[model samples]
Target: MSNVISAKNLTLAYDNGRKEIIKNASFNIKKGDFVFITGPSGSGKSTLLKSLYGQLKPKEGNLVVGGRDLANIGSRQLQELRTHMGIIFQDYKLINEWTVAKNVVLPLMIAGYSLDVQETQAHRLLKHVKLSEHADKYPLELSGGEQQRVGVARALAKNPVVILADEPTGNLDDYSSNVIWDLMENACQQLETTVLVVTHKIPTIFSLPYRHFIIESKGVYEVH
Candidate 1:
């Protein structure tokens, strides 16, 4: 199987003079695979996700995603690299002033797609996430779960090769959580998108069949 992400002996630290959160961590995500990243509150789960998405550079070791060497890539290249990736944050980062369709179209606009084309894509994705009725509503008017559904729609709008999610179900109830997971699972199976989720929902994760990676005070481990 081909690999979508590969990090070798990766070490990550903050620029704020804090201690290294992850040390000598290495892993690979094969194409079309779904993987779970879990750890204690401060065990570097979010740090690892940021590094993988190029928000933070590795202090030591090589990091590669989709055949691009992250360490050697320039800012322009990093932006381009992100075109093949979709990221979901714990807080639904939807623009409060923008309508649901407009929020979902943000990525497409950044990619310089035509407005009409973005509209079509946005509508399709909103329907996919079952938010078609709220297409004209502003994010602030939606519930937390409804807003998160919009986030998922936005994430998948670009048809990215990889999806990175950080605490995607953090504030959701059981029904909403299951809905979000189903959308993510659909993305993985139907779009051949590799999924890397940083979440603390171990009980839910334990029931799913996915490769697991755990980060602790000691180091990173690939758990079967």
Candidate 2:
């Protein structure tokens, strides 16, 4: 498999002036691979996800994604690279005041796409996520799971090559979680995109066809 993201002796920590979250972690995510990052709370799952999306720069070693060394990329280059990556968090980061269609089209707007094209693309993705009927509705009108489904649709709007999801199914019921997982799996297969999802949900251990990586003892390793 081709590697889409690679980390070598990568380290991350908060400025609390105390303990580091991820310590000398090294791993590679191959293109089109669906990998799960699992561990106990505070084991650095979220921190690691953040680093992959360029939110938190590693305090220590080299980190590369899509053939670009993240540690050395300029802000403009980072922005361009990030355009090819999608990130989803536990919370559905939707604009409450905007319609669902508007929320899903925001990324395209930021990327300077035309208004008509953005609307068409947003509607198509909303249909893909099974939320087409709710396009004119507000975030407050949707359930938590529905909001997340919209998030997933928006994440795919730019045809990203890699997707990093942190606790994506944390608050959903079994059916909703399964739906989200299936959608992600399909997206990866159809687009040849690499997916790294972080979650503590036990059911995930047997839920999907993913290579599991456990974060423990300040290191990351593929589990048997």
Candidate 3:
């Protein structure tokens, strides 16, 4: 399989290079691969994720995603690249004013889909996430897990090639976390989506094969 994400000698720093978080890390994630990146607090797991989505530029080395180089990508080019990616955050970033269904269809709206098509896709995704009953409810009205479920639905709405999740299950209970895992696994298996998740713990419920990497002392290593 071809690589969907590639990094070579990637060095990430902050405060104008005064402090470096990830140094000389190299890895390649192929299409349809399910990857888990784990580390302790302040270990730069989230920082590395940010680089993947173009939120943080590399201080050194080459980084590529979906066949586009992020080293010196312009604003317009970066925006175009992001449309093919789905990002899920630990802190569910849903619009409070929009209803659940509307939040889920935000991507479709951005892509200029008609109202009918957007509503149809949203309904299907809401059902998949088991949140169809909460379609009209506001995000704040739901529990943390429910809100995160909506976030997952929104991320999958666009049928993105790669899903980048940062500590996706950090604040969830086992049941909810497993629910999220199942949805992501289905996306990988059925939809052929590449998934890269950064978490403190990789749940034991995963039945499919996956790749695990750990960040420590400013280096990334594959776990067997």
Would you estimate the TM-scores of all the predictions?
Answer: 0.95, 0.94, 0.98
Which candidate comes out best when scored by TM-score?
3
Candidates' lDDT values, in order? 0.88, 0.86, 0.95
Q: What tens digits encode model 2's per-residue C-alpha lDDT throughout 11-81?
A: 88888526688888888888888888999998998988887878888888999999988778889988988
Give residue 191's lDDT in candidate 1 (0 to 100): 84
- Clash count for candidate 3 is 0
Compared with the true structure, model 3 gives a TM-score of 0.98
Residue 10 accuracy (lDDT) in model 1: 84
Writing each residue's lDDT as its tens digit, candidate 1 over 65-140 gives: 9998887889999999998788898899999989999999888999999999998998899999999999999999
**Cα shift from native, residue 115, model 3 (Å):** 1.1
lDDT of 1: 0.88
Model 3: weakest 10-residue lDDT segment is 199-208
